[model samples]
Target: MSKTALIFWGGWEGHTPARSANIVKEMLAGHGFDITLEQGTSVLTGSDISQFDLIVPMVTMSTIEKPELENLVAAVRGGTGLAGFHGTMGDSFRNETEYQFMVGGQWVSHPGNIIDYRIDIAKPDDPIVAGIGGFAYRSEQYYMHVDPSNEVLATTTFSGEHFETIAGVVMPVVWKRRYGKGRVFYSALGHTADEFDVPQMKTIFERGALWASR
Candidate 1:
């Protein structure tokens, strides 16, 4: 049987969570994985969650119920892989403390929301980013306050024509961290549908999802 993947997407509409989640769900389906898509995290009951191999949160912002949040954290820690991009995974759950701990990072700011920037692949031999290159992107260069324990996979240095003294700062744009028996992968790309469709971005996102699964 094909592997099962659950995609929970909903929150503030500003981040375009539904669109991002659909892109990933379609890609995973193409890879022969059975995929389920949900509009919001509220629909995930504990029993409803136990049937999948992976849990993907395409949520951007909002309060997640404590029970739902615990179920999600437990699901991943108990061996279900979790992966997604931008605030959908990292900068999510503005009021849920446990949710933030489960994902391990949060988006603090993106100086100019959408502009061009360079993302450098730091670990070339890592399966997810092995052949990925330094690519130029036209999207938000995220300024995130991340967990120090995360294994940084790729980074983007901040520089732009709109500001001064914001140059030469390298922050993680992609990373992974272990939680119990599961694996978590996060990419800071995908600020827009077109951004997620970039060749390099698609490779990173697709490979990350496959790698994060149990």
Candidate 2:
């Protein structure tokens, strides 16, 4: 059976929510997904969202109503898969810590803003990042506060060039975790939709989302 995915995108235009959602839609469509792309968070204010096999929130740093958040939390906890990349998921819902709890991390800063860095596969045996070696990347090197329970798939070391105190710090770039019976996946890469052009980045993103599908 074809999997269904709901992508509700709207927030800061700087992050290119619409473009990212389009990219995701095309990618998943190629994989035989029936996708519904909505424009805002209003989609969640309704009844149940547990009908979709996956939920991808392309929104970044936006406010979600209490009841809306409650419904989303309940749906994910009830076995709906959740997946996203960079600020869309990690840095999204700035005031909603409960949403951050479900996402497993929150972006506090980018440290250097945008610079060249390398991402190392932390778990080479994990299918999400398997066979993919470390690769150089250019974008925001996210310094997030992450949950230790996450099954880290990739990591990147901070050079301390931007933030001295965090120098030599090892941060998770990709990870997967469980919320009740549902699977959640996140990646710190993809600062922009164009970042998906990188083979390694695209591969890991696609794999992680597929793995997160219920």
Whole-model lDDT values for every prediction:
0.83, 0.92
Local accuracy of candidate 2 as per-residue lDDT tens digits, 10-127:
8888889999999999999999999999988888876468888899999888888898889888888999999999998887799998999999999999977889999999999999
Cα RMSD for candidates in order: 1.6, 0.9
User: Weakest 10 consecutive residues, lDDT, candidate 1?
Assistant: 43-52
Residue 144: error of model 1 in Å? 0.7
Clashing pairs in 1: none
Model 2 worst lDDT window (10 residues): 40-49
lDDT string, candidate 1, 42-136, tens digits: 76774657557888888886777878887888888889999989878876787776666667788888887678888898888899998777888
- How well does model 1 score by local distance difference test? 0.83
Error of 1 at 152 (Å): 0.9
Which candidate leads in TM-score? 2
Residue 190: error of model 2 in Å? Answer: 0.8
